[model samples]
Target: MKIDQLATRACAPPGLHWPAPAAAAAEPAARQAGAALARQPGQAAEQALQFNRDASLQQVALDYLGRLEERAVGVLQTLAARRSASAESALQGARAGLERTLEQRAAGLGEVLDGQLRAGPATRARVQFEVAGLASLRAVQAAGAETLLFSVGPQAGGPLAVVLDEHLGPARLLRRFNASLGQAGVQVRVEADSRLLFEIDEAAWPALREHLAIRGEGRLFAATGWQVPPLREQSLQAELRQAPAGPVLRALGEQVLERIRAAREYFQQQQSQLRQQLGGETRAAAEKRRVALDFVERLNDAKTTAAGAPSHFQLNARAASVNRAIARSALTRRSVLGLLA
Candidate 1:
């Protein structure tokens, strides 16, 4: 139903002649007239024969042009069909390749993300000390000057010598004694207008307790009107209460990461199958792939965020140590004045 422009241009018009039809029609009459001139009779016949031959050659050429047009059109249609098939095949293959590439990349990312989500354990390295409550003491007197001495360790590794002035009041004397003890690396606090408050530093308590053998012949506390009530001897012990909530949070985090991973994989697989089934030039397939890829990228970002969260197990362990230290402090602080006495 379609016209070929090349064929139409190549063909000659109907009812038209290479030599004008009017001129051909006049040829016989001109020959007949020439015959009447006996002197030019043969020349007229020869001219008539040449005219016929020319006409025949012209007709043959026109037929050849028509056939050539037909053949050229056929060749062009064949080439176009072949090219179309080749292009279609190549496009399909390209889409398949791209889909495979996306799938492989997603798989690799999933592996890395899964590793991060289920990451390994970590060591707890932080040391903590927590103390609570207060201790108190009244002043005491010492009996000697310069000669009076005190010892901390059972073997007396650090010996302290004290000399008391009787003229100083109990409060003033206690203040002076505490000041001197501070210079000797023994920290103490006075409170309640009369009592001393105390709690040992966790870091220093262990070593100090192991060698504790306070000796002062009762003078260090006795000289300041300080009373010594036998320490209640509360047991120094602690239990881990209220563990770090990291484990619960970590478990939930891993679960969420797993969901993201599953979603990413689902989309990746869907896209791969789509590519294998459809051509790259297919608009529907391309749209689906775009959507799937976008979701995968979003899920990957979420996975990265989940992987960076703090480790709950490690946090809980550190918290437990801190709780133990607090409990130990509460137990160990019986009386501040007892240690000095």
Candidate 2:
């Protein structure tokens, strides 16, 4: 018989006709009841397992965010302390640290998503981190024209001569230098008046200036002496320089602060959503357990009812025992025996 049928019969009105009990009937009913009982707990157990996995991933995300935040804070503190000093090396170190932290944050987000995928479909659907401003920061670091211009170096083999185009604007001129120089550790910039400004390390500037000739259109200007100048100038004026570390450090610090602020806000919102989801899952798991427990109770009652009543011979034996108990009570005059009678 089906579990539902057994349960209904278990709760039936007294005097209702029931099927005679036999091993054949009893065995199937018991097996059906046991199967149903097993299914209930199986569902609850699966839900609990899923909930635990989600909770563990949440902790992993929290730990990753905490470490990222700490690293960002340390960078900010170092920048603040050395803001006034001409600590170029220290400032560069701090900037490098900030860059490393940003890279780590991106990697951490990837790991979090991978973990969610491993966890299951439910977690993947529900959990997501918003990286709003981070992409832009990374883009600036990776592809910003100025950053490219400042970090270029000389090409492989040797210094190559660059022919400047008079028609090219300041931006084009800057790109031209990077294309020729590769990343020669030379910093190039454009002035307000469309003049290209080049700065290289003081110790190395003389050798580079002598070897790397610049060919530009230079027309002859007639003066009182009536002299004719060459069609092109072979040399370009550049500054033998130290990098202006103070302003660069300050700018980097501001960028780092902005990135941290945006990331913190995003993480806070994500954490709040995760907590709310966890709470809902917890309630759902509790309800599932309660449902499983109720099903087990009903299944137990069904099995008991399916056991059926005693035989006619057992009824006769009970009546005979009652008669003996009554006779004994009459002789003993004991209240306990009287109650039994």
Candidate 3:
């Protein structure tokens, strides 16, 4: 009999007709054997139904869990994509800001350079004259050499002199020559080795170089036995106060540009790192961004100084470059220390 039928008959009300226990016991052996056989199949059918129900429930639970896991992964991926986008946007903005700042600095530097070039007087020129010595002027004189003559400054009232004479001695000769040279605004100094050096004053340098026109006259110095020593020629020099040329200005600009580019790249890397560490908008992250923005704002403005000379501009550029390095180093130090702490 089916399990449901068996259950229904067992639970019937008392008024139902039924076989007596004595009649069942008195049944023939063949009938008893048939009843035992019928019970075995009914028990197996009930066991099979219970197993199918358990397997179905287990499969349903597995499917439900798999779907839940897939949904969770999808949500996490979406969140990560959003965080990455935000990071990219922030980096781009910072780069744009840095570029703007660099452009402004370059423009300002150019103007200062132009002003420096224009400040000089047309007549002003830079020059240097070097004078060195012979072993002994007395030796040349004792050998009966011809006197050497050289003049400094304009011909009209400039100092002119013959080479050292033996009777005067080096000391006396230097003293006599210095007296007149000093009066003419030219400086003369005797070295440890009795070599003499002459240099014109800055106030009179240009005119002296222009008209003095140092040239050999009959090789007078060579007429001294050992070929009287030759005077070194003077050449134009750039004064410290003079402005640099275009190439120099461009070189300076390149130096500053390189530094600014390095700083920009550094800040960009730092922004990327921050995004990786803190993907979501939180108070701590917001505060850190604010600090970074403050740094950017401070970097936007630069200080420029206008002085009377190009030397001052050089000094200013050096000072500004130093300040930039210090600022960047300080920021890097703070970040590293904060991480370690």
Candidate 4:
């Protein structure tokens, strides 16, 4: 058992004290000595009275000593409290002075750092973007840049976004952001939302599709938020295909998190509910890869409708707004991969 547990158990027993035989003997001896001293100068009855008086005096002295000890304790405590208060005041003054100095410095650099300092955990998932070719690109840094959305380069070179170069797989965004956020009370959670976007090179898109060997009928993709200038037109697209959470660890983690947050355990008493869900939910496996399947499929069909060289007006009239989303790249493959890592 642990020592504290043992101590607790020991406390359950009765606590008791008994004077040692020697101590009891000493008390009696003192009483006898008092009696003898009293007898020396008095009659027998008077000596007995004197003995009681002497014993009372001894008790008074002991009581007085106890009062002195109590007073000493009180004095010590008061002195300690005074010292503590003085130290606290000194510290407060020093802190206030430092704050004043910092305020002055901030005023000197007013409006320089107006950027909001908010950072939090983002929901994580892995994205596999095939390298169209090889070239130099910028990677993200913990203390430097927080995110890298997209980049551009020659058509022969691969993505201008950096990965650790040797690593690929589902990695939690939390691992990279632990020190980056740098606050104790600030909380973080990896959340999932409606959609994520990837911006890829238009020229590289055709090459990447072939390299990945995806043979989907038509996939939805998009690129968005164009400010900086680029070599190609302001657009990119991808052929989305069904992909699995690679490796046993990540697959298990995803399943575990879902199950923990599951509203209800459908097959709590029964067997294989989760397993069945993972494998396939009825005819869904046969259905389009996911819910987005229809949007992209319809959008792609709408894009190339009436395959002759058509007028701009006809193309515009036939185009679905949904296809615009698919064509526009919001999240680049490089950026997505970095978040996953």
The candidate that wins on lDDT is 2
Off by over 4 Å in 3: 1-128, 132-146, 153-155, 213-341
lDDT of 2 by residue, 27-105 (tens): 5764674565445444545544554454554455556645645654655566567745555456567656545554453
- TM-scores for every predicted model: 0.23, 0.38, 0.25, 0.13
Q: Residue 341 in model 4: shift from native, Å?
A: 80
Error of 4 at 20 (Å): 61
lDDT of model 3, residue 191: 60
lDDT of each: 0.37, 0.43, 0.40, 0.30
Give per-residue lDDT, candidate 1, residue 323: 41
Q: Supply every candidate's count of residue pairs whose N, Cα or C atoms clash at under 3 angstroms.
A: 16, 7, 1, 13
Q: Rank the candidates by lDDT, best first.
A: 2, 3, 1, 4
Residue-wise C-alpha lDDT for candidate 3, range 1-341, written one tens digit per residue: 59996798899997985544433343353245335434534543453344334333333323332343343233233333445666546534433433343233213222211111211212232223544333344333344423444455454365355444446766666675566555655656556654455665444664655544322223324333332234443321122112142344334334434433443444344445544433332344345445544443332221111111235555455345444433443344344334323
Off by over 4 Å in 4: 1-42, 84-341
Indicate whether candidate 3 or candidate 4 has the larger lDDT.
3
lDDT of 1 at 208: 41
Query: lDDT (0-100) at residue 324 of candidate 4?
Result: 31
Clashing pairs in 3: 221-228
Error of 2 at 45 (Å): 5.5
Model 2 is weakest, by summed lDDT over 10 consecutive residues, at: 231-240
